[model samples]
Target: MFLPTTVEEVERLGWKELDVILVTGDAYVDHPSFGVALIGHYLLSKGYRVGVIAQPDWHSGEDITRLGRPRLFFGISGGNVDSMVANYTASMKKRKTDDYSPGGIGGKRPDRAVIVYSNLVRRFFPKVPIVLGGLEASLRRFAQYDWWSDTLRKSILLDAKADLLVYGMAEKAVLQIAQTLEKTKDITSCHGIPGTVFWTSQRPENGIELPSFEEISQDKSKYAKATALLQFWTDPYRNVLIYQKQDNRYVVQNPPQLPLEQEELDRLYLLDFERRTHPYYARMGTVPALEMIQFSITAVRGCYGMCSFCALTHHQTTHVLSRSIDSIIEEAKMLTKHPDFRGTISDVGGPTANMYNSKCQRRETQGQCKKFCLHPAVCENAKVTHEDYLELLEKVKSVEGVKHLFVSSGIRHDLILMDKDADRIIKKLVDFTPGQLKLAPEHAHPKVLKLMRKPPAELFLEFKRRFESLSKTLSKKRYVIGYFIVAHPGESMHENDYLKKFIQRNLGYHPQQIQIFTPSPGTLSTAMYYTGIDPITGEEVFVERSLKHRNKMKQNVNTNG
Candidate 1:
């Protein structure tokens, strides 16, 4: 059973033999599809006692420690820490906020709460094994460039003092870790688990070492490609040899599984919820903002959009699999039944909102398409249709108690505007949409859009006009939130100047939430950012996002008044 995060409450629950205690910073609300709720529920079904600590202000070390140290394992993730950092840095410049200052917990510093929690755990129970997981740890799995600090840094595990780092989908590895820990308390005994990186006293002095390049690489070309790719991988430290015990070597492995069938996706969502009605509600107080209605739901995992700058496609393996409509409805029903139910659903979409039910057309023939579609030109044989996604939206909207269903995820404007069914979806959105639609055109410049592998700006403008026309006809107020990227490699000052004018003329000088391009690990843009050259071709390039350039852009906006 899962208990809320309170010592007395946990004791009263009498789940001391609980096989695992999953500690997370994300909320217990399953809507947004953060990993904690799913993993915690999965553990409970396996008969493990579980508890959730949602967004505990890590500043109070006591708050984290007070959860009653259990004979269990901890799971942690900060939603999307890398993106959060990038967003924070960009926001700070515009707001003139000192949040990222040395004294502030902002900037590229490890999440303060996560840092404090780790220190507190070590201080209180030094021997208890601590494993770090989530985007924060995973993307920084190797030494990569840190845009803020402008230097390469080692893996977050080494910096955070975590005993192990679990990268990629942690379902299997987390289960194995819990079962193994329940049987024994030794860290060294866990060296054999797949999808985990660990360090032990008995291991080689440098820790569990990965296999050398020669052993893992089949050819010199592959090694050269990896080495070249590594140069542009940005973090805060230099790359070091980190071994994966599963494959018995240091090389990166293919991501685990990409569930394609609806049943598999449903099983992933049908995880057990063991928390009783009372304690679960009571623990809500411990969370800073625990509104049940503010939960998010991921309709799809993995994005085929394959934006050059996005790490999601690479990390998630770019196979767009969606939760079944019935599964989505079921989860929505559960969210509405919560005592504090609000009429609105916070977010209902994944990497891209409109791409629900999207899949490869060649799935039946190719078994599964492993390679990402990374062309500037849209695929002529695009398999997923707009009709399929509209059906999903209709089903989701029909769920009882769902007053407002919103799409907080990015929209693939290319697909939405190109397809005839997409026109219906947009019209439906204007008529039936709860209120807002967030779309990411990424850039307005043709050359930059080409590099980002995004739809043409003209297409987005046309879609915007059509959406506006629909909104006017329906007598509904609707607006599109545009997303743009700045400081991409090869983006010139002249280009940004033109972009600013374009936003002023088109998006109306409202500061269109521009993001400074930070090269995360394992993206084409990252490769370009690091080497000052494109990885696919040996051509030289200029990487943008210098501190001066960021300041200049901000100044331009401020002065534009």
Candidate 2:
């Protein structure tokens, strides 16, 4: 059943007042893929009366107050994607459309949506506890580089005046908050919970203090150092507590919540999600995001790719969490019963489809590995395999109503190349992929790929050759579509030229998918973009700050210059 979004829906559910109200910047889709839905559903599963206020009007208190006041706390999210990224492009222009919106229109959400919604709720219900989560809050939990403003901003918790900020996949932390508030009746008592950040005047003992916001904002080198330190201490098992002084108060971040056990992860996806946007939103128009994923299933939760330009590690962490096969097949069987089921599962994977069941026992015993897991070389301790994933897919396909199951999520090419059973994996992926296998090689130049923490270009080429050969052997016509990034932190015109030549000499065609680097918050690449220094190696990098030059470099590569 869908979580109540309106007071009428709440009343129909026989609830006098909601225990928690979730505010988001996206149209409500009660699917597990959406964070707000997943969290709202989880709270309901625990017997809390939860409601959602999606894409409320920030200009007035009317829309924000429609659900009335919650008995417990208000949860705010900047939707699935960050507000700044949703509202603006890489070149910092206002985006004309938002996929998560009712009609796929832009301007439905405001800039800094999390902060805006939190302040809006505070204006109406001044004393209600406000909890912030989702991509925007998670990535900005620490003071980091803000690309749109070109300034280092303080943590979103301080800017939003939120009582608590839940980072990463926040199902566990948020439930703990609800439980704590139900018993103690004081929101502040919920501080120091795993996966939560709160501000305190007293310095936290034994906490690793990052460079203060004042220090990092002024000194780029210090900012890089802080970024490195925060990432280094991200493991939940490590039990590292980190804090950074904003001004007078210090923001203390407890160690992340441990990866949910298989049973715990399995239960979250089995919730009775309608798998469609709420009727209220459906009447407005088709939500583009929902349309794409309503038929898809999230087979996994977290990723361990740890790419420099990606924020998956900071938000989802480097842990690769997969649900049990029986649980996934159960969800697949349920999907077939839905009225909208068309016998095809659009996707059955997470951040990286092939990373399912990929485990690193060494990292679990000893904290996060100091070495790169998949960048320069796949670490020996990192066991990259596809046996379990292949079995999971085969079982899902064997479901009575399931006809076609596609692995649409980006496949880590490095993993496939490193796997011992490469032939079987490639053949299965070719059969599963509709036609084009999505691979993100990022760039061809060695220095730029190194700065981006991507594998050597030669590895990608070898994988492509094997994949295309397998497609031919299996009598399927399939091709590898490469995703490239131009003008990243270390890429100059010379490096971009190398990328252009590589495309011409290797692929023989200008690949359609290419993007200019945006340098968003909470990414190692963004730090290098802002500081012109790689934090890990402490070496200088060339950054293209000029918009014209950045655009020209992309144009040159696209035009096959």
Candidate 3:
């Protein structure tokens, strides 16, 4: 069942007051893929009366006030994707449409959406405690560079004036927050929860202090140092309370919440989701994002690939968590019963398709190592395998009503080459993949690839050769397409030219999935973008900040296609 979106619906449910209210920037689609829906259903199962106010108008109190104030607090998210990225393109021009909005409208959500919605809620209920979560709040919890404004910005906790902020996948932290508010009735008292950050006037004892916001704003080197420190302290088992002085007070971030165990992850997926947009928004039009992913299955969460430009490393962490195959098959069976059932299941993988069931004992005993699992080369400790995943694909495909199952998630081609059973895994992937298989080899230059913490260009070329050979042997006319990033830190016109030649000569096509780098908050590449120095090694790197130059590189790469 869908959560009540209006007062009339709330009344229809015969509930006098709601325990928690979630406000978001996207049209509410009650599917597990949507963050608000997953969180709302999780809270509801825990016996909290939850409601959602999605895409509320920031200009007035009408839509914001419809749900009124919750008995506990208001949880704000800028939808699944960050609002700034959703509203603008890499070139900083406004986008034409948003897939998450009803009818795929462009301006349904405002920029800095979490801050805007929090302030709007405060206008009507000044006394109600406001809590912030989702990608915008999670990434912006510290002072970082903003690409759109082209300036350093303070933490969203201070700017939004929110009482607290929850980072990472927040199932555990949010439940604790709800329970604390119910018992104590004071938001400030709800500190010391893992996966939460709050402002405090007093200095916290036994906490590591990051460079002050004032210091980092003025000194680029200091900012780079702080970014490195944060990444180093991300392990939940070994991390301590870390604080940063913003101005008059300190922003204290508790240790990260540990990745949920298998059973916990399995239960979250089995929640009651309608798997469609609510009728309230459906009357407007269909959401294009839901249409693409409604049939897909999220078999895993978190990724070990610490690519410099990707946010999954910071948001989901470097530890991989996967659900049991029995749990996954059960969900696939549920899809067969849906009224919108088609024989095809669009996807059946997670952050990285092949990372499914990949585990290392060192992570449990010692926490994340400074060395990456796949980068440099696959570590000996990195037990990369595909036995369990191959079994999963076979079982899911044999389910009664399913005709085709595609592994649409990103696959780490480098891992496939390292696996002992590479031949069998590649054959299985070919059977499940649609016409084309996509691989993200960001650039061809070795220096740039090193700065991005990706495998050397030679590895990608070797993997492409093997994949093509296997396809030909199987009589499958499938093509391997490459994705590239332009103007990342340590990349320039010379590097872009090198990438163009590599694509034309080796890939034999002007690959279409090209994009200029945007410096979002809390990413290693963004740190390099802001500082012009690689954080890994304290050496200066080149960055293309000029919009004209960035656009020209993209255009040059796409010339022959």
Candidate 4:
């Protein structure tokens, strides 16, 4: 909660008085890379007075009106509302036929019609010039296949009735939109913004004119395939297009940066830390917990681990960069000043947490070599060492408020074990980590592992044994292994059975997590589902995880444990 300041003070900041209000369904204030905080900061930087309405109960219209109405609206989302609705709708059908529902036969509509939090604001205040952006909006920018409904879906712009849709990194696009709205008050005029998409009302009725996406030229084949699937976008009826009104044409702008280079990564981290810290700490009357206690820091912007079943790599791209150790140490110092600051640092890494300063180095002529050179299989490169990472951990642990520092992020076992310096870092992590360590060995079978492009199950077992031994010697807490995607394409019953038996024999039957496989849009798995052939091998496969089967698997795991 923020202290009440006079509206005059807010107006003196050169912000317009109450023209727009940004609403969100996320609980946390600083979501690191995601959520409304980043955009809110960007808007404030552009001289827009914005107030965040976090985690509002959308079931009641009265709850929404408490923040006061606005001339324009911004809604932000974190991919939960849509998942909840899908789960609710599915469960209702399974209920006893004779049971009468008290809330009527209809589902609860969220405050916003679109998945992005911004679009939801438009649902309550229609014709108020709404703008939607975030992960939900970014991924669904163009017509794409939705596995749950087994149909195509249109861009969220049409479905949410938002005036404009911003994709990828929201900072630049959001600032541009705020500046334009403050000047002209017309969203259509701001269509040419680098990372935004909007309907051209003046275009022909048969097909809408879409702005040429810069990425489309670089990756023409991918764009062509994505465009061809446009016709498949449909609602539950599988007839009416999900997003209608403008001709079916959609534009997907080039995201701010596809794969951030080392220098860019450092710049983003430095700038964000500087901008977000002071205001955030001052508003709360203490340093934010995210800075000190438990928060994730992105050491690298994108992931190179192109796991077929994972979405992070597909959307964020498969490039890696490491932030400077100096920047990380400075940020750690800032976290120590929080009033409720915990002694423990939850995580000190990014996407694949343990990957720090690990880059492919290529020797060139004239005795000069490229620093942080990205190789084809960068993780497996010999020169990419973890000495810097070990030094980084040591520096963070030396911070005044930080009593115990732990690495809670995913560990790339193969990368850690391959390099001697990286292995030393892993050894230190295991010996010093406070609580349960988390690692995602997504699958056990070699076939499944290969499909995921992950290291073999044997390697994970080896790492687990090594960690367990180290933990016992150091008297540390137990470790938890995260195994996900039970019914991915090409997974056989025999493979699952073998995996279950392997868990029973090695790590005991009681596993902490077993997540169901969800086929996210724009992944390698989705491509396989569409073409009915494995994208990597072109082999035919079968995916057989129904709701009932997933439930049964959970039950079986519990009973076996």
Candidate 5:
């Protein structure tokens, strides 16, 4: 069931007021895939009255005050995506569509939604505790580059003046917070808690101080140094408090919360989610984001692929936690009962589709595992297997009413090569993907791939050779389509030019769509873009800053292969 979005609905619940309220930038979708719905369901299961205020008008206080003040706290998020990314394309052109908004319209939410919503709430309910969660807050927990503004900005916590910031999967941390606030009524005294950050007057004696905000702004190396510390300190077992300064106080981030174990992961997916948008949005029109993911089942919560351009590191763990095969089957069975399910499952996957049922075993050592899991080479200790996934798919394919099951999320090429039964897995995967398999090569140059911490470009060529041979032998009509990032850090203009020619000569066609590099906050790539240096080696790298030049690079991919 959808959470109460109006005061009358709250009254219909036979309650005086809600215990928690979630304000988001997206339209209300009460599906487990949507963050607000997942959070609300978790709180409800814990016996707290939860309500949601979604896509409220920031101009006036009417929508903000409609739900009234919650008794405990108000949770804020910029929906599933950062607002700036949703509002604009990488080419700095305005976008006209938003998957999360009603009627697929843009401009439903402000550009910097987290700050705007927090300040709007403060206007009427100055004393209520305001908590920030979701992608925008998690990635911006520390001050980093902001692409939209083209400058380094302070942490989102400082700008929004929130009471607390929860990073990564917030289920475990949020429950602890609810209990603490209920008992102590002290947000400040609630320290040493995992998966959270709060403002402190003085730095803790045990904390690791990042290069002060001023020093990072003055020197590029300092930013890289701070990022190195940030990435290393995210390990929950071997972590120390990390802090950076604002004007007068410091933002203290506690050690990351321990990842949920298998059984725990099972319970989260087993929760009662309506798995669709609230009926109110039906009047406005269907939500594009919900419709796309409604038939999809997420089997994992984290990734080990530490791509510098991706923010999964900040929002999740290197270790993957997948739902049991039985649990996944249960969800598939549930979908079969839904009226809208048309016998085709859009996807059965997560972050990196094949990083399932494995561990790096780096925990055996008592320090952070600093090496990239797939770059250079796959770690020897890393357990790579496809038995679980392959067997699970076979069983899911046999389920009644399942006409076709497609693994839309791309299985990493490197992982496919690592599996023991590569030929069988590759043949079946090729058979399953409807037309083309999405491969994120990012770039075809060795230096660029190193900066990305991805496998060498040669790996893609090898994988393509095997894939085509298998497709021919299996008599399947399948092809490989590449996802390339244009103007990435460490890439000279000549290299990007080479990429276009390389695809044409080898792949025999030009890519129709090209993803332009945008320096989003909290990504190491963004750090590299701002500092003009590699984060790991602290060596200067070439960055294309000219908008005209970058657009030309995008056009090169479009106009030619």
Candidate 6:
């Protein structure tokens, strides 16, 4: 069932006030893919009256007060991305479109939306417990670097004046907060909860101390050092509490919550989701973001690849948790019944599509992994197989009214090479995909690939050759659509030229999906961007800071041969 949004809807449910209210920058979509919807529906299963305020007018209190006041707390999210990153381009210009907004509207959400929404809620209900979640809060739980302002900023909790911030996937933590607050009615005492960050009058003595806001703002090396330490402690099995002073109070981030086991993951996906945008936005126009994921299924979460530029490692951990096949099939069947279902399922994959039903050994989770799962070379301890995923796809195909199923998220080329029986997955996808299987090679140059923590250039080359041979055997037409990020740290004009030449020699064509790197918080690449040095080696690196040069790097990939 959809969460109650309007006061009339709440009244119709025979409710006086909501237990929790979620304020989001994007229009509310009642699908498992959207974080707010998953959490809202999950709360409903726990018997809480949850309401959502989607992209409310930040300038006024009209929409913010539509659902009265929440009894437990106000949950705020900057949608699926960091607001500044979402609203602005890498060159610091406003973006013309926001897929998450209704009608693909831009400027619907203000800059730093979590901070804005939390402060707005405070103006109306001064005593309400303000909580932050989603990418903005998760990545900025500690002191972070702000690309928009080109300055280091304090933890988002201090800027937002929020009582608490829950990072990572917050399903388990949100439930704990609701139950604990319902009983104690004291938000300040909400500490020792996993995956939560809160302001404390007394500094948390047991937690590891990081470079303070002032220190990070003053020294680049300090920021780099802090970023490495912060990432090191992300593993739930070996993390200690982290404390960093933002202002007068300390922001204490509790150790990350453990990944939900397979059964628990299945249950979360099996929750009753309406699987569409809240009807309140239906008349405005289509939400472009939904078009990408309305039919797609996220069969897994987290990534073990641990690329330096990617945030999955820092925010979601690199354990590569996944859902059960039964749960995925049931969801796919439900989609056939969806009103918009065209007898096709857009995707059934995750951070890495092939990683589904495969995971690290028991000892791999005891602490942080010492090596990347697919970088340099596939780790010896890594489990590489695709039999279970192939079986799941077969079950999905057998579902009545399902005409087509595609793994559109991405197919890791390196993983494809690692799997001894990679031909089956490639053959199936070549037949399923119209012309291409999406792959993120990121860069073709070795130095840039080293900075990216991705596999070497030879892997993509080998995968391409194998793909050609397999497709020739079937007499089918398909190729890899490579995604590249240019102007990354350690990548100057020299690497861009190298990338241009590498693509010309190997693929015989320039890629279309190319972009300049944006130094976002909670990424090792961003740390490198800020420090102008490799965090691990402390060696100077080339960082492209000029807008003109960065723009040139983007164009290098689009010039077809």
TM-score of each: 0.78, 0.99, 0.98, 0.74, 0.97, 0.97
* Model 6: ten consecutive residues of lowest lDDT: 362-371
The 10 consecutive residues of candidate 3 with the worst lDDT sum are 231-240
Q: Between the candidate structures 4 and 5, which one is better when assessed by TM-score?
A: 5
Native-to-model Cα distance after best TM-score fit, residue 188 in candidate 6, in Å: 1.5
Q: Backbone clashes per model, in order?
A: 19, 0, 0, 10, 0, 0
lDDT of all predictions, in order shown? 0.59, 0.90, 0.90, 0.54, 0.85, 0.85
- As a whole number from 0 to 100, the lDDT of residue 445 in candidate 3 is 95
State residue 490's C-alpha deviation in candidate 6, in Å: 0.5
Per residue, candidate 6 scores C-alpha lDDT tens digits across 1-561 of: 788889988989998889999999989888888889988988888899899999999999999998988899999999988899889998889998999988998999999999999989999999999989999999998988888888888889989988999999899999999999999999876787899998887977686888887888778988888887788776688778888877677888899888888888888888888778888986788898888888888888887888998888877778777788888889888889888899888888888887886656752558665556676787777775688877877888789988988888767787777677777777776766757877888998889898899888788878888787889899988787778899999898888888898878887776777888999888989989888977766777889889998998888666754
Q: What is the per-residue lDDT of model 1 for residues 1-561, given as tens digits with 9 covering 90 to 100?
A: 344566666679775544455554444544224466667676666777777665555545665666666676666665434434523455334222222121222322234334445666677667777777777666666544555565544556555676776766666777778888778876556666666665433334352233243432333233224534432221112223334322222323222333336775676665544322234433433322333224556678766676778777545545566787788888778767766667677667777777677655564234333333535555665556667667776777778887777666677776776675666778877744556676777777776776676777888788888887888887888977787777777778777776777778887646547667756655667656766655555566666656788667645643474
Q: Candidate 6 vs. truth: CA RMSD?
A: 1.5
Candidate 3, position 379, lDDT? 84
Where is model 4 more than 4 Å wrong at Cα?
A: 1-20, 28-34, 56-75, 78-120, 123-127, 182-184, 199-247, 255-298, 360-383, 470-482, 526-531, 556-561
lDDT of 5 by residue, 399-458 (tens): 898888888885788888887788888887886787888898888878888899888877
Q: Candidate 2 residues 182-208, lDDT tens each?
A: 999898899868999999899998879
lDDT at residue 349 of model 3 (Cα atoms): 89
Global local distance difference test of model 2: 0.90
lDDT accuracy of residue 266 in candidate 4: 59
* lDDT over C-alpha atoms for residue 300 of model 6: 81
Question: Candidate 3's residue-wise lDDT over 106-197, tens digit each?
Answer: 99999999989999988899999999999999998888888889888888999999999999999999999999999999998789789999
The number of residue pairs in model 2 that clash at the backbone is 0
The stretch of ten residues in a row with the least summed lDDT in candidate 4 is 96-105
